[model samples]
Target: MPVRTAVPADLDALVALELRAFTGDRLSRAQYRRHLVSPHAAVLVADAADEGLLGSALVFFRKGSTLARLYSIATAPAARGRGIGADLLAAAEQAARRRGSRALRLEVRVDNAAAIGLYERAGYRRIGLYAGYYQDGADAWRYEKPLAVP
Candidate 1:
């Protein structure tokens, strides 16, 4: 699957993908619109012409910080187990590095074993946790991976 930086044309499809992959705390259409043009964000999508939109990732970077945060990542139900998530994650990391980020970070709900396992296998180490990080009072495990050797 080909993953590319998302453009305005992908807004609706991206929003739909987010809804399909997540239950709550999903990104809004407006948020997706803004992030598409935001200088601080890298919005990437897996676009397979025949399949339409497959997945998306919203990774953020601070102006003066070397740390890049993966705000969100989601793959459509039909695309799961096909490694689309890993492809999006790799693309996001490359984008962050191009933007001068040395490390990437993300927070996943503690109960999401699949996601947690994916992160671990990708070389991301759990470094901390946020109590009640989700709107539903679910805790989150924070993980980080260095894009460049420190």
Candidate 2:
């Protein structure tokens, strides 16, 4: 899978992947449109030559802050278990570094073992927890990873 910055043309595929991959707390089409053009955020997608979009990762950077937030990441069901999520994550980290962020933080549903494993394998450490963080009333575990300054 090749990862690159998302463009307006990717809107439909991105929205479809988000809808198929997540059941709640999903990003709206308008939000995705805004992020695709926002200077404070990076929307990245992993594309397959034949399959369109395989996954997407959204990261947000705040002015004067070294920490970047990995707001959301999702892989299409058909692309799961093939490392698409990891590829998007690595790309998100690089996107953050390019914007001068030194660390990346994210929140994952406590029940999402796959996502938790992906983050942990990528070197993110659990720092805290948020109760009732999801629309479905599930708790979220906060994780962070310090990016190496290049």
Candidate 3:
């Protein structure tokens, strides 16, 4: 398995993985494309030598000083349970820290226990909650991890 910075060439694979991982969610391909082209955004891909994209993580920088917000993270169905998600997350954190980010943050649906577990194990702490944050009216739990000691 190899972890690398996602390039425009990986757009198609990233989009496909987004659709699969977001099954019930509704973000269009155009939106995904726009994100890929955003100046403050980045996507990391985990590829298997013989296969292809195994996992992907999209991180966005909101207006402010050095803070990265992980928008969406997905691992190909066949690639789950193998630490691919963890690897992608570690890559994202490393990139953010290199970019001088002060912290990393993300919001996950309250019902997404699996992801919540992953985040917790990754050193993210639940900071707060947002009611009805998802289109489906699901509550979201905000998680954060400091990139540097304050």
Query: Best candidate, lDDT-wise?
Result: 2
TM-scores, all models, native as reference: 0.97, 0.98, 0.90
Winner of 1 and 2 under TM-score: 2
- Candidate 2: worst 10 consecutive residues by lDDT? 93-102
Arrange candidates, best lDDT first: 2, 1, 3
lDDT of 3 by residue, 53-128 (tens): 8888888877677889988788888778899889989888887887778899999999988899999998999999
Better of 1 and 3 by lDDT: 1
| RMSD, one per candidate, in order | 1.4, 0.6, 2.0
Compared with the true structure, all predictions reach lDDT values of 0.93, 0.94, 0.84
Compose the digit string of candidate 1's lDDT tens values, residues 1-150: 799999999998998898899999999999999999999999999999999999999999998999999999899999899999899998989998898899999999999998998899999999999999999999999999999732
Clashing pairs in 1: none
